[model samples]
Target: MSGPNGSETMPLFEAVHDQIASDEDVAALDDWLRDNPDGQRQYLEFVDMQHEIERQIAGVFSRGPDSRTENATSKAAADGFLFPIHSVRWKVFAIAASLLAAVGIGWWGNSRLDDKPIAAIDLDASPVSRVLGIVTASENGLAYSGRRKLESGSALRSGRVDLQSGSMKIRMESGVELFLAGPSQIEMNDPLQVQLVSGTVTAEVPDSVIGFAVKVPGLNVVDLGTSFGVSLPANGQAKVHVFDGVVDAEVERSQQRVRLKDRQTVLFDGTSVAESSYDQDLFVQPGMNRDAIPTTTGDVRFLHTPPTSVRVGQFEHDLVLCFKERTESTLLETDLPVSLDAPGHYRVKPRWQNFGAVPRGTLVDSYFIHLDAIGPEKRTREGSITFNRPILGVVFSSSLLKGQNEIFGDPRTAYVTDRTNPKSDPTLENETITLSADRRTIRFSWRIRSRSDQVRVFVAADR
Candidate 1:
């Protein structure tokens, strides 16, 4: 392809270079490029040549000809023309200027015939609203804030955020913090209002954020300076749970209103709303408080701050400590094949592992139950823990625990696993295991030895 004056056959190339190609011209060019492979290659080569010419022309204007930036061919051409370097550049510019003038005349003639302005890139652009939010944290999640990956420091736009997996924490510019759990979809209507399409999202509104709202099916849950969680299932009704302060829930169709305060929740079945007691642990959202500790007795200590590592003999006291590890995350690999990914009452057995399968698209959180190995006493310990959520499975084998430590273990805490002693004993005869009928609690009695007795509970991350 060549310039309009350079060759009569290059009108299409000139129109494209000037950003003035019409729809029919574009269609014809596309068809030709697709049908002829050699033409496509030559077309690309022509484009590269045009770009290089454009670059050299731009340099002549921005940098004077005395700048010595032009190639040897340009210098040689100037010498052959028997003119100064500056005059040669001006001659090149004059030729380009005449070609542009011819293009303008052709566009003016077409515009008069068609009665429409040329749709070129020179048109003034329309304004766009690019709202942004800072992602404070991301945990095993894949999402997009606007057109970019939704990770920490991502700029969120005024559009829908699709959370494909795991959890994400975002703070709006208005001081509203959103804790999002996936497979979810949320639309940022503005800095204060959000629309929930499916899955779960929790918002903590500060005093500065006024009229913060979460819009779901059938109802718009508006915060009156409050924190709340909005959940909408794929094939079920919508739910709004208020953790603190007050909120006004209004139906979209009829504008029916209901005000809920601390510890109150509502279920909207697309028809009417039913008020219920708020269960804080119902949604396995990020930034949730795991205040529902189990009831324990003898040789058991509920740790508010967990010890640094789960290695043997880290603590001098011979007692078991229980703490919820972390919020729900996508389990990429399994330490031990889950025996009960579904809700059921069962006891863990040595051979039951690798016998069951975890369902696809499921998320799990872990709870660490560590029995600290004391000195040479080797005392027998008895303990029981009653959880508020359903247990998926448990891992007691030292080998399995070694694999799961980095997977589900609290990241702040370190764990020790020894490859040298892979064949060490894991189960004891004096140990006893019992899972209640609802599968929410487990009782354990282990014969403590020189090394720690560790068991990790893998539980469902949903209500």
Candidate 2:
């Protein structure tokens, strides 16, 4: 559900909305919480407020099966901020109600600090700023001169501070972090800054606009609020990655700027700007954007081919596919691998798209294939290609059900070809698929080796 306005994943606002709707009050409470702090501070406070609100509701009820015996006991618990409802069964129901009631309510009224419209930048502050602590506004200028070691939880605000030299842990105040190597200057305006100095830095901003900015000697690295690493090249060059969100890059010397998204990066070669790629560590978990996933029927076609080719000898010629998008967004990536019959001479011409059938946004998926057949001639070759598109009506279904004996413990049942059951209708499209005590239709796209055109395959499942 959307938050106060139409935010799909603003948990705090959703929670407050739900609470207000159910209780018929708390508009004042919600407004107070939101207007009191910045988005960063409000989010933190919301977490605490949610917990306390839960406690307060619990105190109104009697203790479990002892409702007849705990009138006084319950009243005492209500006196304090903590509710003492002791009825096990009632407590569960109360907790569930409380959670449901505040599903998407945040106290957003102002446009400056908290609950600012989604996908917006705080132009007042440094578009991206990182200060150690204590920003002293000097008569001459703003001096961020404190030499503080910004550890994991360390934070400070000032006009401008250059990270002269040192390994400091910097947080973006929104769960994002910036790791400065050394010898770098970080200037903080309200929402923008410059790496005017030099040095290497690594930053992780799962959400957009929650990390550091770059000010190359001849260029600028405006973060799209993603996780990535930046280094100064031999000349006055710089390299960056969009580990999660999009990062904007502008070539000061050339007056060029570009946005880099997850798994994407760009390089400034002292004279021009170029996009590049690198290997991501598997141990790191990326931050997520609640509203970024596409929820429509679409296609993901490769406007450009993947730079890295699949190694023919290491994996099976079959390529498995997967994707990363919001859960509410319907995704239909075939778990089955695409057959790559020819290796050395074979060119990948795969396409994924969102056909504008349902929602809109890019559907990002991973294609991984495992080859179990390898002969002297190499029975199977496997590799991967990544691509995205922001359209609709294209979904990938998993092949896990293939060769499986049963779904939901019922004897393996094949759906009848006739349309007696909706599951049997291949033409029917559904956004949700589940093999439970129910049934559903599955969509598949397939083509014969020599078929002149692609055929759409449909299967119905009976639970």
Candidate 3:
């Protein structure tokens, strides 16, 4: 294992092993071989043998998880001593012979190279159509229907909006207001996705809808759980505000996920999502025709103002919706049922439930939603609703309402079959227990076919 240059070839194997173990780039080997032509040939030969050993090891590891490649390498080194004709010196032969003499002569297996298949993250919202060249001061626009892709340079004014799938603020525009409802996807596809992108967008998302995803470069906002809005700086680079429900802010690069509650906002710049502990001023109010009573939760309140119908955008999974009116000029607020749950249990089944990790179990109930804005002229609403526990996925009895008096509740006994997907079968085994009368409440009861512990539920909403 010694080279003609007086350099040792066995040391080369150790170096390569270290690099591969550290996950370092393989290109570094070229730099090491630049000076020694003889060393380069030996390195190539060594690599060929190593690759073959790795291939064999991979098969063993795939079949038996306990097997490893290091044992194979040690075995190959031990076997090298038998050919003293290839040795560069007596010292080389002695070292090789010593390694071969060691006990446990059985060659060790190789590590597994099998890669797990990853599923695509479903982004249901559509792209923006005609986007503003630049939003400055106070300018407003509307998104009618379809998808709207965004450019990094688009700016949003306080009162301006690009309803359907536009960037910027989610709350009401400075003084100008826009609304997004139904179903759609809005994104801020900027490298620095930060700017004065501020505005108010009232979103009315119901469970019956589907496909509402908003992204601010580093953040992934998924809805279909409930309604909410996201406010950002007019500049693409800025913070995020959640007016209602919970917004699961996911960082793509790191795969980190965080949940934001109603009136809670977080800031992200590709690296992390930071939640604000301070109580920010409540923006927007309900219309006069409706009785708006703000929850006791800090500055967030609701007052009905003069009746005004805000426009909304449309999307593939559009559903019936009602908006919160500013009746008495109180703090702007939206209503969420107590028993609402997030879309986690049904969206992606647990890996353990996929047969590889755990046995198959019958699905009690499952459904997904898609919500988008009605038009460019409407305000933008983004965010979600999550339950404390996973439930037999929600079965909406009726669409959402604009006022408390019009709230939809299932106090009386009833059973509504899920029309969204035919696969879901609802039964008492997956019974859903709801708590309504103001505050958000979520609860579910189920009997396991076998022993099981806890389940995770996720909620995502935006306005």
Q: Could you tell which candidate, 1 or 2, scores higher by TM-score?
A: 1
Using TM-score as the measure, name the better of candidate 1 and candidate 3.
1
Query: Residue 205 of candidate 2: its Cα lDDT?
Result: 50
lDDT (C-alpha) at residue 137 in model 1? 60
Across residues 1-463, which tens digit of lDDT does each residue of candidate 2 receive?
3233345335445555454333423453355456455543645665666554443322212113344536643664454313333334324433443444457433222211221111121111221232222211111121235654332212355433455443444433233345554555554332224353455656665332332465656766666556666766445567776656677777765677787777776777777777665635311232334232212111111111111211222221111211221123223343322221111222214332212222223232321111112233321212222222212122222222121112211121221122233232222112122111111211123221211111111111111
Model 3 lDDT, full chain set: 0.31
- lDDT comparing candidate 2 with the true structure: 0.35
**Per-residue alpha-carbon lDDT of candidate 1 for residues 1-463, written as tens digits (9 for 90 to 100):** 4333355326787788777999988886777677677777777877877875543322112223223534542654454422222323334533443455546655323222121111111111111332335464666779875566765434465567899997887766445788888888887745556778788999988653446778876688998878889888886588888888899999877888999898688999897788865655556545435544555554454543344556654443434667667644555453446434444434455454444555555577677887665457665676577777677777766666677677778775667655535444334323566666787777776776545667777666764
Give the CA lDDT, 0 to 100, for residue 297 in model 2. Answer: 16
lDDT against the true structure, per candidate, is: 0.62, 0.35, 0.31
Superposition TM-score, candidate 2 onto the true structure: 0.29
Instruction: List ranges where model 2 is wrong by over 4 Å.
Output: 1-155, 159-166, 173-176, 206-212, 277-463
Once fitted onto the true fold, the runs of candidate 1 whose alpha carbons sit more than 4 angstroms away are: 1-129, 277-281, 288-463
Q: For residue 265, what is the lDDT in candidate 1?
A: 85
Q: What CA root-mean-square deviation does each model show from the true structure?
A: 25.6, 23.5, 22.0
Model 1 residue 382 CA deviation (Å) reads: 58
lDDT of 3 by residue, 1-463 (tens): 3462345446546566545433342444455567878878877777777764543322111112112333543454465533211112222433433454565342222211111000010111222321212221111223421233222112222122345333222321111122432122232222111122334333433332222345555566654334555545445443555665655777877999887777676767658888754325322322222112111111111111111111111111111111222111121133233123332232222221221111123221111221222332222222232323233223322211111122221112112223322222212223233333221322332222211111211122121
After superposition, the stretches of candidate 3 with alpha carbons farther than 4 Å from their true spots are: 1-202, 277-288, 291-463
